[model samples]
Target: MKQWLVFPRQKVGLVCVGKPVRCSGQESCSNWRAISRTQILLHSFLLFTFLLSPIAAGAVDITQQLHRSLNSSVGRQSRDEADSLLSIGEQQYASGYADKTIASCLRALELYHSIDDLKAEGLTYNLLAKAYVQLGSLKEVEDSLRRGLAIARDTQDFQAQIFVLNNIGTFFLQQGESAAASKTVEDALAIAHGVKNIEGEGLSLSNLGLVAARLGDYNKAIKLYENALIFRRQTGDAIAEANTLNNLGDAYLASGNYQDTIATYGTAMQIAKTNRDRTNELRAIDGLVKAHSAVGRYERTFDLLEQPLTLAKELQNLREELKSFESYAQLYKQQGNYLTARNFYERAIILARTLEDSKQEVQLLDQLTKMLQLK
Candidate 1:
């Protein structure tokens, strides 16, 4: 369960299970666009390589054989080839090709198992689970994660176990089974503490906080996030620290402590900026905008959203771009600037359709239709 911030140029998004499903606004759109652009860039680069290469087939084969021998283990190129395939799959997944990702992960897992690499096996299961999760396969989530857990336990790898536990807990959390999620993650935290793994401790703490937050235990959530923040700071894990801050800010917001929310997000913003984490910075910007808007601080909202919007557009990230459009709609809606809201809403709708996100397309259409009806 990655606490994702919405921002332009952010590289990672941890969408929590069962969180309100917002339309993948401008930010998400920009992310998709960037992915598309990267693919095009890579294809062009490969095309150039193909054009430049000599057609000495025998010589190329001999060179390839030598290179393969240098890279292969025991004359078995299976592992290396599998790894390359896995890399390709990951690149495809990142570029928004889910089916290709699943295929690639499966091939990699098969190779890893053939080579008897427990670590790679576990990781492949985790990745496969992620792809299944996106495809809305709950059974796959349980099955894949359980398989990963078994591997972790077999190896007695506490770190891997921690990841499995957190992943499982997140799955349960998404399923709305709060108690089970809590129990599972709490046990993982206990193990992390036993092993004195500070990074795992921080992550476990965040999971616990998320569970508590879902349970309406804001105080407990705050405590967990605060503890996680300490561990994150100690490890100099700015990304984790920023995520913890965002979670803490969410808790504060839920409790109607707007000032504290502002403070928490402000800290996250500073940390993200310092780390040059574009994703977290974008999320921080979103938090900042929401916080300011809640307090009727239009000037602050305007100032904060400007850079996020610019970055989203520059990166061609569809998600961020859509978010920017939605944020603008929200902002104007709040201010009773209906005409401006309508304009932004229209732009968001177009972007959503362009990205082929049916969910977002529907949501935008519904909102726009309602606005039109009001007019």
Candidate 2:
């Protein structure tokens, strides 16, 4: 449920259940031509590692209607048995068992389809979309979402429509189709407003903020995030609040408003800590370190980075770890410490290669080459 913004260069995205990653430089990021179609699938789906770690903020919960639909299906089969699989599939998805979720959902899908329960079948497709994303299967993701949307509309299930629309918007954002993303999210927003579903409102607003940010319209992004925050704060969901703040902090940083960036990131860190969300805590710390570094607070910058480096390694978030190395390289390069900077860049390149992020490896190498050239 991460809000995401895909750009041409410096590819800002997030990896947690939150937003998109942002690279350190403004170099062009045209991966489409060089990478295969399978790689393109990763483009829109892999934002969790680098964007701004918030899983899908305000994840759409199973509504009562959806529940009944799930429980009501399965002709000639044991009704209780099918319900159990559907329930287990939801549990598997929540537990991050991607393969299990897919298995459970596929089985459940057959039962629902056999019963001709469009609402239930549509919900199953939506469930499959979640599992497919983790597998980096964009083709499956698109197919699931399209089927879900069609079912939602055919059955006139307004709630299901809102859910499918919001998801479709996020998918478009990953595809780097901001215009389509915007339109799709706006449709969700309208439906949410009509239904008075505040969580939907917040999710749609936050996603629109991502679209705006991708378009380099920080002011608009900030406004949308603020509105989203208002709705989130009312929901008593601290994690969602922290995610929005992290995203808003990034927007502030992008706009050169360092003080606001610092404040926003600080708040995000606090909320993440209270929730014991180490991944998001790392994201907040990264934002703080970047803001501090940009304003020449070298001592504070290093201070801010140290713990997060350890935390990132602990989390096995290679991209976040690489980001810290890149930050170290940048800071040392600025201080005329070329040898130290080169060492950090080398480490980062290795990590990027391990992650199979060729673009990131190339970016790190470019930074290394530029630094050596200066020397």
Candidate 3:
């Protein structure tokens, strides 16, 4: 028998294949919210494409049976089956099985619709949106989120409403509609505050900070991030707190506050390390390197680059590996070490070609060509 990992649906305060779990405080909600938000944001970076292919399946048989049960009846039994399917779908999503997650969620949605379980249907739509995000199906993502939003409103599920709104804002942010993103997140913030959902409120605030940062309002971004950090800390959400610290560091860096940037990123790095979150750890390290470099701390910058470079290789994340090489090359170029810079640039170009990232390849080639001309 294949072991299936189960996770609670924090937003809905529902547990699947486990005892009841309650979010009594912001801190209590932190772990689930932090994990979910990280997964969502990671996928958001792959804006126009999927980063992973469907992996081998282990829960296929059980999910298939759930689908059959959900489709075969229309009564209390069917409703129970729908709930099971939704639970399984959530599990699949948490397990990183995007394709299976989509299939399971769709079946659950159908069952919920048949039973007029609008709230459950709405949640299913939210799950579908996430799966669609992983698949890079922009249209599907939009449609599912919209549908989920509508259901949340119709059912007056304030928590679900806030979650959907935040996701929509994030999607808009990724699409480069900063103005729309800001407005959407502001709406989410207002609703979250009204509902006294500290977790939702904090997340919205963080997203709004991102929008502000994108708009070059670094001061405003920092202030918002600070407020979000307070809420994240209040809830004992180490991951969320770390992410906010990273964002705060980014704002400080943008404003040329290298010392503050380094301090903030260091805190984030420590938290990421404690959480064993490699992605956030890499982000913190990247931010630290840039800040150190800006302050002429070349030794620290070079030292900081080593871990992310190794971590990128371990993760087999070509994009991050390419980033490491490019950063190394840029730093060498800044130091007038053309030969070293050229070597790193060549490595970056090779990774870009392997990843079939034509745009990045072109950019690297152009940079290398310019470096050669200078030589």
Candidate 4:
């Protein structure tokens, strides 16, 4: 039988080199004296190997095969390799390359599973979930999130659990299950509080706000979002803070507080611009356009849509382009310019056809017919 020696400071048990010796306290622990040089070297080598194990995994990479072979030969790849892959995946995701993002994350997930690294596995699942969401694969997103939650639970990783739970809540919200979303995010909030993780708590609060907003509880949602914004700011999460502000703007808009909506969205837009977060910036611009139009600031609405339309083209985002065209059509219609509205509606229909969105194309065609009749 192998004897074990416990190191109090390290909180690890080392195999005894010879006969086991008991110590009453730290002062009497003399097992170090019995450890041979060769045994110490062996232990050191093992410790080094354990320390060098991969910290995290993420999406695919161009040199993925090379990295995998290197990892196998060296027993582990460097943290830089994992970070690089993660960066690539994020870029791909932002660029709307859902398939590439999925492929990268899947490869990273495989490596993580091979190493039995639960933390990495959980994170990779989150990445995969986002990619699936972009691809409109709701079932795959659900599966990915469930797997991530399981890994977090099994590993007793409280932070990871909170993240997975928050994402699950958001998924529920997207599915129009507001009550379920609220319950799930509440669970996440509890776990975040238990772990004293500020970031997790903030995210949970924001997600809960989303649930409330979906349920038409705009005041409650505003309060929750304001609280979340504070936490996000404290944690230095500018992106999260901007998102919360945008949510708050939406809540205010729902409550018929047009001025507040405009103000909140303006702040969010500034933050998004400073952070170079184009997605959030676009969201803020959309919010501003609505708020401005509500207040009869038609010219301002058109001015706001200008950059958003330009950005949609630059990003090759057909969906946003369609939205921009529709907004323009609505603006012209509201100004009583039937001809201009008809022209914009035609442009929107063209874009919808390019996207192969039959339903949207039909809707736009109907609107165009109506506008032409008005003309």
Candidate 5:
């Protein structure tokens, strides 16, 4: 019978070796013996000492403090603080802190609405839509994006309209309504091309490419990605260029062109590192892992997974954590380490469930069931 044991480690019960060998969950717990009184004392001592250091708490509370400060301010200070909060919220949203992001963005929206800042209101709504999308609140996403889009159109702000359109299309794409997404994005693309807005065109093209890729049109996806890259370069948008390069890499990978996939991702990684775009850099690493795995490059796959895994843990990003787990699971599965694969898959399942990501949960469950059956 499988043993039911108490999780003695401080972090979580994430690390447990079987006949397959696992490591301690806590890095500091490994040197200790079983959960003895002395070991518990030592653990408490270490945790307290660590918390008292300069790096105590890892100090992420600064943002929350800032948010609090903004709430207490008035006039110019309030407006300025609100602007700062918006930036912080956008960063959090991009990093997948959906609930926190929504709170921050809503705070910003309150300030902007109080001041009658239509542009700011529109932008905040868009950010709110992004947060709702991450939370899988489809109705909230639709409402927020539509409100922003209406405002942008009413103001006749082409740039703002383009931004809202892109986000709206992305929302639809996330909902698996690709045809509607494509129509909305195509109109945005036409407008961008008409106004010669290179940045807008690049973004729209990338969205179009992603839509095509989701539809299994690898050739069209590749073409759109390449064209987007061209526009990105012409506009000196290195971030967008790197993103399109990564997308192209994915297209080639899907089509079984490992060499091209590797080369494309390599270029994207170089650019991402140069730009210090950790998000895109992690994306490139993910692509490298997939491409290398397709070619049976086990060592390369492990190496590729390590950077993103470390980064995700360091950043405490749930999205990156899930991606790292998936990558690890696939690599272990490919290497015939079914036990390790199951471990990572279980970790991913935990995260997916926390995020209420039904799609990912169902997919991971299917993989986990298949792997367990093989045992």
Candidate 6:
């Protein structure tokens, strides 16, 4: 028997034959999601067969063998393989491998959509948005979140809806849309409470705090972060816990609570070190520098700036590296060293351009022009 996959919108299709069917050509179509009644039964049988292995052997190898069995044709990998790849993507995201997370999530998304796993497909799109934001890929982030949020809304998956909404709110915050961000996170918080999802509740609370902080309501922001911290710590999610603490520190700094800012950022930095969370470590260091420098602790600020700069370079995080340079420029400007500050500003602008971060580049250029005028 032969399996000829005919995609109606295109001039070409793929061919597969025999047991453990191998596809003959590349495929990039969504029609595979239209499963017939018989095909569903066949897929269930294939999925069941893949789950059996009494080998008492290596964990991942068994999973690999199962993937081989179920991948009978193009766009037809089993849910298990897609799940495994998605798990890897999640780990890459937590460990700050933004580029790798994008690649893995893209692969998992394709497999999930082919299998009609709309929930996982939606989740993957949100995951890709998170990765894109880290790399400053603004357009990609917008597109991914748009797709993910639509899927979640259409499916009425409360958990997926909360995830997508929270992410969309965070994206809005980045774009300086404080009102939109607030409303979006409020929607997520309502869903989280209605669904009794603690993790989602925590995330929504944290995002709302970000909105409040951006709007200069430090008191409200801190209160939201504190509540979010309670839930996040209860769940033992170090990544999220550190994120909330970092944001809390920013609120403290903005409100002139320097002592609290130092303490909050110190704890975040400690957690980041223990978890090898390079991204959060950089952020924590940035907060710590601001707090110390605001209090005229230049001695500590110098070493603080150097550490994140080195770490950012090592991680190939162009955005953070440029930020480090910008921070150096700000510090020198504060000390009335215009020439040194101008040099650091130029360096940051070059890195920002390399990152294709027009927003950051333009901001840096403006600051540079203003600083030059001061002398």
In model 3, how large is the Cα lDDT of residue 335? 97
Report, for every candidate in turn, its global Cα lDDT versus the true structure.
Answer: 0.65, 0.69, 0.67, 0.64, 0.65, 0.66
RMSD of each: 13.7, 9.6, 11.5, 16.8, 17.9, 13.9
lDDT of 3 by residue, 95-151 (tens): 445678889888877777777666566667766876766555566765676566555
Candidate 3 local Cα displacement, residue 131, angstroms: 8.3
lDDT of 6 by residue, 298-367 (tens): 9999999999889877866565677779889999999999999999999999986775556667888999
lDDT of 5 at 224: 90
lDDT for 367 (candidate 5)? 91
Q: Which has the higher lDDT value, candidate number 1 or candidate number 6?
A: 6
Order the candidate numbers by lDDT, best to worst: 2, 3, 6, 5, 1, 4
Residue 323 shift from truth in candidate 2, angstroms: 3.0
Question: What is the per-residue lDDT of model 2 for residues 164-240, given as tens digits with 9 covering 90 to 100?
Answer: 77776776666666776688789889998999978778878988898898799999999999999999898887877
Worst 10 residues of 2 by lDDT: 15-24
Question: lDDT winner among the candidates?
Answer: 2
* Model 4 agreement with the true structure over 171-288: per-residue lDDT tens digits: 5555545565577679879988887888877778877877777788888888999898888898886767777788788889989999899999999999988987676788889889
Which digits, one per residue and each the tens of the lDDT, describe model 1 over residues 152-217? Answer: 676677887776777766655655566766877788789989999887788789878988987899
The global Cα lDDT (0 to 1) of model 3 is 0.67
> Candidates' TM-scores?
0.75, 0.68, 0.66, 0.72, 0.75, 0.70
State the number of backbone clashes in model 4.
Answer: 3
How far is 65's C-alpha from truth in model 1 (Å)? Answer: 27
Return whichever of 2 and 5 wins on TM-score: 5
